[model samples]
Each structure stands twice: as C-alpha cells, then as structure tokens.
Target: MNYSIGDFSAITGISIYTLRYYEKESLIIPARKENGRRSYAESDIAWIQFIKRLKDTGMPIREIQKYAKLRAQGVTTMADRMEMLARHRAVLKEEIGKLEEHLSNLDDKITYYRTEIRKCTNLREDRRTAEVSCCT
Candidate 1:
C-alpha cells in the first residue's frame, strides 16, 4: 500500500523536510503521484527505519549514503555492503567499550558520594542532639 507524505511522516516519525532532504541526499526515493506529491510505499517505511537506526548508530552521512547506494545496487553488492557493516560494527564495539568504562567510573563516584553522605548523617545528628542537651 502507498501512503501520502503526511501519513508517511507520522508513521516514520521523520519530519517532511527531513524526508525531502533524504531524497535530495539520494538516501530514499519515494514514488511521485500524478500531481507531483510523494507516495511512499510500505517498503519505504522499512527503509526509513533502517536509515534511522544507521543515524542513531552515529554513522556518518557519507557512510550511510554509501550504504544506500550499495543497497540500490541489488544483491550483487551484498558482500561489499557486509564489509562496510562489519567495519561499522567494529567501531561501534570500541565505542561501547569506552562508554561502559565511563559508566563504571560514574557509578563508582556515585557510590563514594553516597557513602560519604551516610557517614556525615551521624555527625549531623550528634551536633543537633548535643546542642539542645535536653536538661530537665
């Protein structure tokens, strides 16, 4: 089934302007209606989702454009596309490793601060009780 540009944008969560920009970048090519409006095929939605995932992965525009070009080239380019994806995966793994290290560091700092606060709570209670001294 085909969808209007507006429907496509709602379904894909991509702005109409971004969709047009994708077309300009040759990342997607939606069919045109007789009146020159866009008619997005169901496959176009899937393609858009894939593009979104690539963008989320921090893939550069030129790299995604290369992947899109490879996709347009049909099954014969499968190996080439796989190579590109493999390289991207390696980089992503490295990035994830660094992120995990940072997360661990943050968690350690939070634990240290929490312990310090707990230790200070007793001091605070002692100061409050000692000041009043409650002499009857």
Candidate 2:
C-alpha cells in the first residue's frame, strides 16, 4: 500500500523536510498522486534506509546521486554500483583502522592513570603506617 508523505516520514524516521530535500536532490523520487501529494511505497522504505546507511557511512550526496542515477538505469548498472560500494567499503575500513588506533591510545592512557593512582594510594598508606609505628 502507498503511504502519504507524513506517514512515510514517520515510518522512515526522516523529517518531512529532509524527504523533500532528498527528492529535490534526485536521491529519491516518490510517486505523485493526482493531487500532487507525494506517495511512498514499501520499496521506497528500503531504498531510503539504504540511503541513510550510505549517508551515515560518509558517502557524499553527489556520490549518492550518482549511485541513484545508476540504480534508475536498472540491472545493466550492477557492476558500476558494485564498484562504487567497493570504494566506499575501502574508505570505511581505513576510517575504522584510525578509530581503533585512537581507542587503543585512550585505553593506554587510562591504564597509566589507574596505575599512577594506585601507586599514590600505596605510598600514602605506607607513610601513615610508618608514622604510627615510630610514634608508638
């Protein structure tokens, strides 16, 4: 069943304005009713979700528009789509590597701080014990 733009936006968690922007950008083209109202389908839901994923993964709008154009061309563009996705995947992998390195650095710093805190605590306790023994 086709859904009105409001319903589609609710279902997709995309704002109505952004949906209109997507249509304007040619990233998506919802069907227009006789009244010129935008209508979306189940297929549009899946397409929009995929589009969101691409956006989340740092794919530029221009690149997404290119992919959308290729998709509109049908099965003949599968190889082209695959190539685009492969390139995106490589970029994501590189980003993941850098993030992992940053996380490791954070972990090392946290470990160092913990060790230093423990040493300070031990030194304070030892000092207190020595002072008590010498005064007794």
Candidate 3:
C-alpha cells in the first residue's frame, strides 16, 4: 500500500526532515502523488531500513550514495555491491579485535588489583595477631 510522507516517516521511525534530507542526498526517491506530495510504497520501507543499517554500520554518506547508485543500475552491479559490503565487514572485524584486546587488558588489571588488596589484608591480619600474642 502507498503511504504519504508523514505516514512513511512514522512507520519507518525516521523523522520527516531526515526523509527529506535522504531525498536530497539521492538515498531515496519517493514517488509523487498527483498533488505533488511524496508517496512511499512498501518497497521503500525495505529500502529505507537497509539504508539505515548501512548508516549504523559506519558507512559514509558518499559510500552509501555510491552503493545506492549501483543499486539503481540493476542486477549487473551485484558484484560491486558485494565487494563494498565485504570491505566494510573486514573493517568491522578489525575493530572488534581491538575492542576485545582492550577488554582483556582491563580484566587483567582488575585481577591484579584484587590480588594486591588480598595480600595487604592478609599482612594486616598477621601483624594484629603478633601484637596480641606479645601483649598476652
């Protein structure tokens, strides 16, 4: 079913202003009604969702625009699209590796601190026992 621009924005969880910006950026081109208002179709919903995902994945606007251009060119551009996605995937993998390394370092520091605290506590307890026995 066709929806007006406002309805489309609400359904897609994108603001009306961003929808207009996307049109200006060539990320989306909604159909126009006879009165010249923007009209969106079910297919547009899926397209916008994919565009949002690409943005969330750190794809720059220029790259997304290029991908959209390729997409508009039809099935022949599938290889180029796949290559772009694969490149982005590799970047994400590298970032994940760095984050995991940082997390491991933090865990090691936490364990070291806990072990040091336990040692200090044990020393304090031993000193207190020696003082009490000498007083007795």
Candidate 4:
C-alpha cells in the first residue's frame, strides 16, 4: 500500500523531519509521486524497521548510510553486509559481557548488604545501638 510521508512517519514512529532527514542522507529513499510528494510502501516499512534496529544497536549514521547504499546495490553486496553485521555482533557481545560483569558485582553487593543487615539486627537486640563499619 502507498502511504504519504505523514502517514509513513506515523507508522514508523519517526518524526516528519527525521523522515525527510533520512531521505536527504540517502539512508532511505521513498517513492515520489507526480506532485513531488513522498510516498511509502510496505517494503519501506520493513526497511525502516530494519534501519531502526541497526540504529538501536549503536550503528553510526555513516555506517548505516553505507549499509543502505550497499543494500540498494542488490545481491552482490551480500558479503559486505554480512561483514558489517558480524562486526556489530562482536561489539554487542563485548558490551553484554561488560553488563554481565557489572550485574554480578551488584549481586555481590546486595548479598553483603543482606548479611550486614542481619548482623545489625542481632546487635540491636543485644544493645541500643550498633556500629556499622560502613559509617566508620
């Protein structure tokens, strides 16, 4: 189905300005009508969703534009596209490893807090006040 630019923006969750910007950057090339109005098709929706995913993955605009250019070149650039995606995947894996390490550290801190809380409760039962090493 053909949709006007406004309709395209609404469906894609991108602002009209951003849609135009993408067009200007050659990241997206929407179909134009006789009156010089931009229109989008179902394929454009799929393309935009893929573009959004790539952007979400921290792909730079220039890289995305490069990918888009390759994509527009047809099946011959499949290898190059695969290479780019593989690079991004490696970066994502490293990021995930860092996140996991941070999460583990947080879990360790939580466990320490639980133990400290129990000790404080026990000390409070024995006396009016408990000295926490953290405060000293």
Candidate 5:
C-alpha cells in the first residue's frame, strides 16, 4: 500500500521536512504523485527505519546515502555493500577498543581508592583499640 507524506512521517517517526531532505540527499526516493505528492511504500518505511539505525550507529549521511543508492541498484552491488559494512565494522572495533581501555582505567582507579579506604579504616580501628587500652 502507498502512504502519503503525512502517513509516512507518522509511521516512520521521520518529519515531513526530513523525509524531503532524505529525498534531496538521495538517501531515499519515494514515489511522486502526478501533482508532486510523495507516496511512500511499506518498503520505503522499512528503508527509513534502517536509515535511522545506521544514523544511530554514527554512519554519516553521505555514506548512508551511498549505501541506500547502492541498495536500490540491487544485488549487483553486493561486493561494494560488503566493503561498506567491513569499513563500518572496523570503526566499531576501534570504538570498542577505546571503550575497553577506558573501562580498564576506571577499574584501576576503583581498586586504588578501595585499597586506600581499607587502609584508612584499619588505621582508625587501631587508634580506637589503643584508646580503649589506655582508658583501662
């Protein structure tokens, strides 16, 4: 079924302006009515959802647009699409490595603070014991 721009916007959670912008950016191409109204298909809705996911993953508009273009061109571009996915995977790997390094640093800091706290608590306990003996 074909959906009007408003229906597309409501169902896809993309604003009408953004839907237009996506068309302008070549990220999406909805069918146009004779009067120039945009008619989106269910497939277009799915594509928009995928685009949103790619954006959330930090894919740039240009790259996403390119991917969308390649996708629309069909299975002949499979190798190129694979290359794109490989590039994205590399970026994700680097990001994961950075996060792991940050986590390690945080863990070390936590260990250091915990050790200091234990020492301080032990010292306080020693002081309390000495005072009790002296009072006796």
Candidate 6:
C-alpha cells in the first residue's frame, strides 16, 4: 500500500521536511500522484531507515549520497560498496580505540582521586584524635 508523505513520516519517525530533503538530495525517491502528492512504498520505508543508520554512523551527506548512487547502480557495485563500508569500519575502529584510551585515563584519574580522599580522611581523623587527647 502506498503511504502519504505524512503517513510515511509518522511511520519512519523522520520528519516531513527531512523526507523532502532526502528526496531533494536524491537519497530517496518516492512516487508521486498525477497531482504531485508524494507517496512512499515499503522499499522507501526501508531506505529511510537505512539512511537513518548512515546518519547515525556520522557519515557525511556527500558520502551518503555517493553510497546511494552506488546502490542505485545495482549488484555490480557490491564490491565497491563493500570497500566503502570497510573503510568506514576502519575509521570507526580507530575512533573506538582512541575513546577507549581516554576512558582508561579517566579510570586511572578516578582511582587517584579516591586514594587522595582516603589519605585526607585518615589525616583528619588523626588530627582530631590528638586534639581530643590534649584537651582531656
């Protein structure tokens, strides 16, 4: 069944403006009525969801567009698309490694702060005990 643009937006959780923008950017191409009302199909829905994933991956619009173009070219482009995905995967791996390094540093800093707190607490307790004994 064909879906109106509003229905498409509701189902996909992509705003109507975004749907229009995708169409304009050639990332999506929904059908149209004779009167020019936009209509979407199940394939369009899947494409929209895929586009969301691409955006979530921090893919640039130009790269996404290139991927879209390759996709439109059919099975012959599979190897090229796979290569593109592999490149993106490498970048993501490097980013993850950097983030993990930062996380390790944060963990070490947290441990240092905990040790300092413990030392300060012990010193404060010792000073309190001395003052009590002297006053007595």
Best by TM-score: 2
What TM-score goes with each of the models? 0.91, 0.92, 0.82, 0.89, 0.77, 0.86
The digit string of per-residue lDDT tens for model 3 on 29-66 reads 99998999999999999999999999998889999999
Weakest 10 consecutive residues, lDDT, candidate 2? 127-136
Compared with the true structure, model 3 gives a TM-score of 0.82
Clashing pairs in 5: none
Look at candidate 6 and tell me the lDDT of residue 101. Answer: 100
Candidate 1 TM-score, true structure as reference: 0.91
- Evaluated at residue 88, the lDDT of candidate 1 is 93
* Tens digits of lDDT, candidate 6, 1-136: 9999999999999999999899999998888999999989988888889889988988888988999999999999999989988898898899899999999999999998888777766766878653332222
What lDDT is reached at residue 86 by model 3?
97
The reply for model 6, stretches above 4 Å from the true place, is: 129-136
Better of 1 and 4 by TM-score: 1
Model 6 C-alpha lDDT versus the unseen true structure: 0.88
Ordered by TM-score, highest first, the candidates read 2, 1, 4, 6, 3, 5
**Candidate 5 per-residue lDDT over residues 8-42, each given as its tens digit:** 99998889999889899999888889999889998
lDDT (CA) for every model shown?
Answer: 0.91, 0.93, 0.92, 0.90, 0.88, 0.88
Error of 6 at 53 (Å): 1.2
Error of 2 at 81 (Å): 0.3
- List ranges where model 3 is wrong by over 4 Å: 117-136
Q: Which residue pairs in model 2 clash with each other?
A: none
lDDT of 3: 0.92
lDDT of 4 by residue, 1-136 (tens): 9999989999989889988988999999988899999989999998998888998989999999999999999999999999999998999999999999999999999998899888777777677665645432
